[model samples]
Target: MLTQEPIYPKPFLKWAGGKTKLIQQYISLFPQKIINYYEPFLGGGAVFFYLYNHYFLSSAFLSDINPELINTYLCIKHDVEAVISLLQQHQANHNQEYYYYMRSYNTENSVERAARLIYLNKTCFNGLYRENSKGEFNVPMGKYKNPQICNPEVLRAVAKALQVAQIEVKPFETVLNYAKSSEDFVYFDPPYHPLSETSNFTAYSRDSFNKDDQIRLKNVCVELAQRGVKLIQSNSDCPFIRELYKDFKIYEIQAARAINSNASKRGKISEVLITI
Candidate 1:
């Protein structure tokens, strides 16, 4: 008898602070028996997808503050064929002008909007998802010689992985309502605390995740910890983050920084994985 190869779904979006590189180091830290998996800040969903592909998670609740991102996931989960069809159109018409035109395009259709977001993400400079004060995606066109805009196989795999998961557009604190104590594992991968004053890139939505937001996240983590929810959080290795997660087991790991415009700043940096 012949066995089929495993098809693991990678992140559909190239997200900033994605945990693809850190998964190896984190494998031992993931809960051994996760009844319910929760990833509140579901950027890239690298870890969530990995866990779903490998583990026997009964359920999952994935969420993010970005409505468009969540909508993209929802589109993939519920209407992947339509989303892929729209992306095929995007792939055929892809050009500098079309990129800019689609960037500013608004649509009431969920599948079309999701396809547009995925197209821009693949073709945008550095694959950085940014929005201006007016809540418009302002990133310019990237210089990829051939960016894959409509990947049917990956989209299908992602749709399969997301079928058992509930994707939502909500704040991080909202997970407390759905997650049960002792049985649920919550993974927090929020925007990292900037290493320096000029390195902040937390404009995931139009709203910025400022220092106050970090404090609030720490408070939420504390409450969840008290409630017996298994928790693991990843953030930049900065004094503020260390101070905030001082009570937890902070494991410092080095990860390559690839998103910085300045090549000098795009090197190995210290990041912390806090487990509780």
Candidate 2:
């Protein structure tokens, strides 16, 4: 097996509520000699790319509950150029009518579908990937004159890095169960419990993370820590969040919200960085 090296580049995406800032702040807590890495909630793979770039692990296991997100990763790893070509076409024909038409269409594994996803993600307001009950891509187009549709270099680099790591689409419990030793480091970034009923934005999937899920995740964190797996998690800063990880080291950090469609609603928000 080829030994993994640090210095991999990041994938280009406008991931909503990404942890790029948080991870950079608390990266020192990550295990230096990571034999295996596990990320159960692989949103945009922001932390995954960071670890790959820093040479933290020889093997990585990435899992997500969202099937479409997993499909997008698979497409990038397997057929990035084709996806790029289709994304370019979507960029070329970007309009309100075209956006709705593409949003309503269902074409699995087609390059057009992947392109629409990328195009909408790049051009949509705040790169928010929310869907209605019918699961249509409904976010309005953004105001950028020339958004980057496809980054061939970033795609190739991410594809190569993912080729070396293991990828899965499963429940969080299944992925957490695999980490039973000290050689593994688990970095969890679960869907946060809303700070308030009015501020909730858990629409990544139809099933949102509730208070029960938050408790369940805390239990999983304790289990991982007891088994000696270095763990770190980021979440919304709230009384419930602090109480849940009372036993762990929680760092309160302020980060700007870059994904909200409303300009007034976009601003700095406190977050918790729990390490164990």
Candidate 3:
């Protein structure tokens, strides 16, 4: 019997700092071949999904600091049908009140939580994931006339893609435990340093990624570089960041920004891609 081929899956959720647009421009910076792929801050996982679909990945290790997001990935990887079924129910009952209700809903069921997150992400304002000091998801409802709440094809595709990946909820530095020297590629897309005082939106979890965290990441990059691990990292083009990774090769590129609340602030902005 002939089996159906897995469809190429794009990012399932709309992330604030998603790299979907820059994947093309940054394509040249990606390693030609990867034995193992490591993404520590796997927001929306655009680059990981893209590379996996394109057959550029042999094995992958994906991790993030957010427990909810990691749980969603785990649900999809282990029981996509259950997640999709719950999403279908959500699609049938979607409304402003329903959105708010689901946003505040807490559940121990992995499938339900995953479905709820996908629902909120699809229907939330700008598809941005923001958490309050208490670690509660607080983004309000979006104004999309009609949102795609349940797409079975996309969910199935995502499930297929995640089969080869080992997803985890861990600190970025833990990648050192799994990655082998000279045989792995690690892509770091941590929260970018705030461009200005008002542009800070790094709170995907209750914990904030401050300047010290940035420095720690740079130190990890330095250690990985010395160990012969290939690395690619993206962050805001700022003096602090430049000095942080001064020993590596940095390339500045313009990436469009649409997550800003102010219309005037939404435009192309300079970002840096550091390689080692």
Candidate 4:
């Protein structure tokens, strides 16, 4: 009999500002050991997946303010087979016409909604999640010659990884409620404070993360640090963010993102990694 090799999971969504590429730079920064891990702004969840794959974690708290996203996670965690079944349908029927139909679709079924979001994510322009003034997904269909709309292997692995996590929909500040000791580690990958005028793109959800929210996040970090909670945050390396976490140990991380509206501004940018 052969023993099966463990399958490590990567992020299932193609979220904007995802830290998948930056994980290498963060590896040395992540705590060697942690009992509890919390990620408040769980976008693509590259960091959470990374930590789970690399370290020994007893518990994890993953959350985001996006209701649809949270629901998708719950559906996948609870019933990945249902999601895969629906995704297989989407994968088989994927076409330009069907893509728009799925985009304009409204579904109350959690499994169907999760499948729709995943389909759109793979086929949407740049895998960008942008909502309109009326709070509807407004991104156009992407020009993918062959998009992998469904991958049961990846989804199953993701579901297995999430079995140990308590996923939720909550504000970033709510992290302070549970994380209170050095054993608790919080990795914040908030909607960054824009570095330039053209880069102030926060349309990931209906409620934009404005400057006030940035300040509030800083305060939470300060408080978490005070309680001896291990922390690592990723944000734009701008003066404002710099001044905000002035006392924390800041390291310059080289990052490149194509999320800016201006194509010219999407290359080798500097981001800050604050640790405590």
**Least accurate stretch of 10 residues (summed lDDT) in model 4?**
195-204
Q: Which residue runs of candidate 4 sit more than 4 Å off their true CA positions?
A: 1-6
Candidate 3 residue runs with Cα over 4 Å from true position: 1-6
The Cα local distance difference test for each model comes to 0.90, 0.79, 0.90, 0.91
lDDT at 165, model 1: 93
lDDT for model 3 comes to 0.90
Q: How many residue pairs clash in each candidate at the backbone level?
A: 0, 0, 0, 0
Q: Arrange candidates by lDDT, highest first: which order?
A: 4, 3, 1, 2
Instruction: Compose the digit string of candidate 3's lDDT tens values, residues 95-152.
Output: 9999999999988888898999999999999998888888789999999888999889
Q: Give the TM-score of candidate 2.
A: 0.91
Q: Return the TM-score for each candidate structure.
A: 0.96, 0.91, 0.96, 0.96
User: Which candidate, 2 or 4, has the higher TM-score?
Assistant: 4
TM-score, model 1 to reference: 0.96
